[model samples]
Target: MSTLTDLRRSMVAEARRRQRLTWLISAVVLVALPWIFSSSFSISIMTQIGIAIIFALSYNMLLGQGGMLSFGHAAYFGLGGFLAMHAMNYIADGAIPLPVPLLPLIGGVIGLFFGFIIGTFSTRRAGTVFAMISLGVAELIAALSLIFVGFFGGEEGVSSNRTKGPDFFGFNFGPDIQVYYVAAFWALIAAIAMFLFSRTPAGRMANAVRDNAERAEFIGYSQRNVRMISFCLSGFFAGLAGGMFAIAYEIVTEETLNMNQSGAVLLMAYIGGVGYFIGPIIGAIIMTLLRTVLSNFTELWMLYVGLLFIATVMFVPSGLTGLLMMHGPAWKRRSLKRLLAPYAAISIPSLAVIMGVGGLLELTHFAHTTSMDDRVMTLFSIPMNIDSLLPWAGLIALFIGGVLGVRRLRPMLLDAWADANGAGGGD
Candidate 1:
């Protein structure tokens, strides 16, 4: 009958005893999660989310936890994916005699090998210089992706048939669902392992160096060593994510290790709230869902993503998870209900405006085969599907009204924030 508070107290009282149980529970959950999914689609989504979470978390180790910002994280991730694809090929070709389940380890070893080499130079210069070096390194490799046809498969990249795996207990992984099981199992394992890593001595030192390298140096902790170690570990996990990605997608390309992939990692980690351990996980899941679902609905999705990213930096600098964390105090105080009305009032119109604008922008650039010539210039999200004047008038009215309402509400929202922070009374 112990609650979360009770569990926290017990952990504080006997850390080891509770930590062991936590890990054991995690193991069970990872094993059972795939079984809980109703369909292959759900499992596939979960697999991607889990891999992305691992990738985001590993990236955060360098950026958020170690304060060593990297721009070419995909170097490790893509390197790992390419290696795994090659490994899968080798397995298929009978060049190597390893089981498919252990193919990811090959990717990890390859990533760690390069991570050490890259970290040796990059870790020495942590900030902007390091970022540039990483970017250069990534571009170099990405160019190689097009040149090295012998190894990289030149533009086409590489593909590995997972069906090449030997049957285990009659499970040949012949179906996508079976592949999901494999991916899900590893995804969960990677997540739990990465989380465990965050609690270790190295992880704590990484945090210390992140906060104050000078202070860490004074405490006899070598900042360079700490940074290098973090870089290597982060690379290993990113590689693991790449391996999962390769297996899930069954293809590895130069694009996999390109600057865009690297940027995606940065976006996922920061947008998820890199300040917290669990932030990247939330970010990855939400970002993956958005990438999957939203891309289907719009061609100009990247524009909105850019807008969202800018808004996050400008207003909600803490990211989505941070916003969710903001709700904790109200929940703790049992006073969330009192603020519900205003929150809904502000959110509804705000969301509407966003969606309306988003829809219009997306439709203008849509790449779908069916294009209608009957121009229905819908304004402000009021379905002007049929070429009509009403839509135009409605759009203008909505924009003016929305802008005015938001301007007036801005002061109220600010006051609410101040009141919540105990700066002033609501009256």
Candidate 2:
């Protein structure tokens, strides 16, 4: 058994090492994805992903690593977005430097300014009290957005043009693809920076404070200071993400400063898995994909997402990243291979059923603008039509099959997860 354990550990270590290399290669691939793909829609998706990635990491800084929850996070995001837009206008009008790539810095400063002011009070209390104070803060700022029409632009919001910047060797950000690269670059940078922050001493101290405030204080770390630092850092990066938004869409509105944006970020970060950095990245990617791609398919996407969120909270508290990681031991033992066929069998049909229903619903409603329109996108060029009773019958059959497979496989998956954890006393 010890030999098997050693072998498993060695194999796992080897796999992890290879995964690192894979990631590096994948990062390069992603950065160049714009050049490779000719679709303008793809670039738009990538830009949304970029903004989401930064936003998720920033939220995680509050919830995941810091162990604090703030329902009013949108205040900073909106402020940052608003300020960045102003910065863009300043540059465009020759009031500031043209080709302003440092717009995120301006956004961060705005976020930190608020964080500095608010942290003075909110950092005093942790948990529920802290959450409420943050909510109040968000509401206050949201109200302020309406009142301060001159700066915030009230209901009309603020807009800017990126082409107003200086031409860098005659490369104007006139095209969406060019802007996509800039967004992707910043997204990657923000992700790497946030990941590094988690490994920093301050970040670890935040974790210590989160897990046990009394013990962290007992160890000579000021819990107050720890919380303050976390709040500020979270605001800083969130502002940066907001800046990305301001630049990406060229607009900042009350909606940005509202509870909905904050709630979306909270949901994304938490559902991705707060305990893991990669979790938010995954969460952000999934949410953005759903928002940009799935929503175009069906208005009912939110309903399904809500159901999935509830299911995750109830059954998979750790989110998708954690659930996937739960299979580590079985993977190490080479036993996980046995389940691959079953997983594919279940997942493929299930995805088809879910996405098919979603796609058909959108077609009926005429909500989508995908390349896969009924008139253009035919399966095997057979002129498939989903606007009929036959397609509905197939959908019903698929749904029933997926439900049955999931119910049957769920218990087995749970057992395997338990085995994986117990096998190595993994936390």
Candidate 3:
């Protein structure tokens, strides 16, 4: 028993050490990223990613931690952003003496206020009913944005000048780099706060209510109250993200509160893995990259994202983090090497399949959107004559061959995966 206790203590120590190291590394990366990327565009992307991280984590607080699936969470986000923009404008006009860096707090408060009103009724029910109510609330708020043109600013939305706000420590925050740092600071605080929340009694009870509300009720817990707490906190953080967005872009449009924005946050949370604390952060970064960087290269980016979502749901419902975690047992056993050959074999065919399919899609899109006389198009940096049958045949062959190779290699991968994770496996 003593030996077991000592072993457990050692394990706990190691976990704490790892957690600390992870945090230290993350801080270093956050501080160094702007310097490393340097470009204004890169800074903008990084800033967006930070804001997204906060938003995604907030969404996860609902879907992942509390088991509340919201379709209109963006309502709070948009409200927060719109109000933050207003605050910035007020600051600009000397109506508010607050510094620009403090705008997110205003957004957070607005989000919490609205979340409380919405959550009171929405949290009365769980599951599908809750989801539907959330949707209705979102739509209602979205429509009101148009009706109240003076506040929402109609279709164009509200705009403000971040630079007009009072200086913070001799910096006006007109530069992208300065704005990025501000976002990074808020993101860090929000992330830390959310993390701490997850470890609280309320958080644990929220999870309990999520898994078995009846059981929670039997134990004298109010399921609605637990969910309401989560809902309000989620709104606050989401609004905080909105404030960052407002500061970053100096605009809060109707699109911020639309279903699209809600859907994007949902994707980020689901793709990142709602089960783990770090999952949404990873998802936020990757989704931001896909949305910003990948969109620059492909017009079919949305279609690609849809395909990825389908694949994640069918094959890895736990998201990208879940997929990575699947290798834990093999890694622990030092049998990871056993699956490398099979992974490599499967990856080749997969790459070929993706390339072939992408090329075909590009060709189809080009043919439909462009004039018929535009028979020549570039694919994979190679100019191909779309009018010719040879290119079509080559692409078809590549796709078919890849499919066949994948079919053959998949079994091998499965077998290796099983072997690597087998009970008796070792280095």
Best by lDDT: 3
lDDT of 3 at 376: 90
Q: What is candidate 1's lDDT per residue for 1-427, written digit by digit as tens? A: 5599888887777977776787688667766777787577777787788778778888998888888878889989889999999888887787787777676777777778889998898887577988898889889988888898988888888998876765557765667666666666776677677767777888889889888888998988888898888899888888887887777788999888999989988988888888887788888988888887778766666787778788888888788889988877766666666566667777766765665565545444432433577555433444455345555455555556666677777777766655554454432
Among these predictions, the greatest TM-score belongs to: 3
The CA lDDT of each predicted structure is 0.78, 0.81, 0.91
lDDT at 101, model 3: 91
> Residue 176 in candidate 1 has what lDDT?
69
Regions of candidate 1 where Cα sits further than 4 Å from its true position: 1-37, 363-374, 377-393, 410-427
Q: How accurate locally is residue 244 in candidate 2, as Cα lDDT from 0 to 100?
A: 82
Quality of model 2 by C-alpha lDDT: 0.81
Error in Å for residue 220 of model 2: 0.9
Candidate 2 clashing pairs?
99-166
Would you give me the overall lDDT of model 1? 0.78
TM-score, prediction 1: 0.87
User: Which lDDT tens digits does candidate 2 get at residues 180-208?
Assistant: 77777777777777767776888899999
Clashing pairs in 1: none
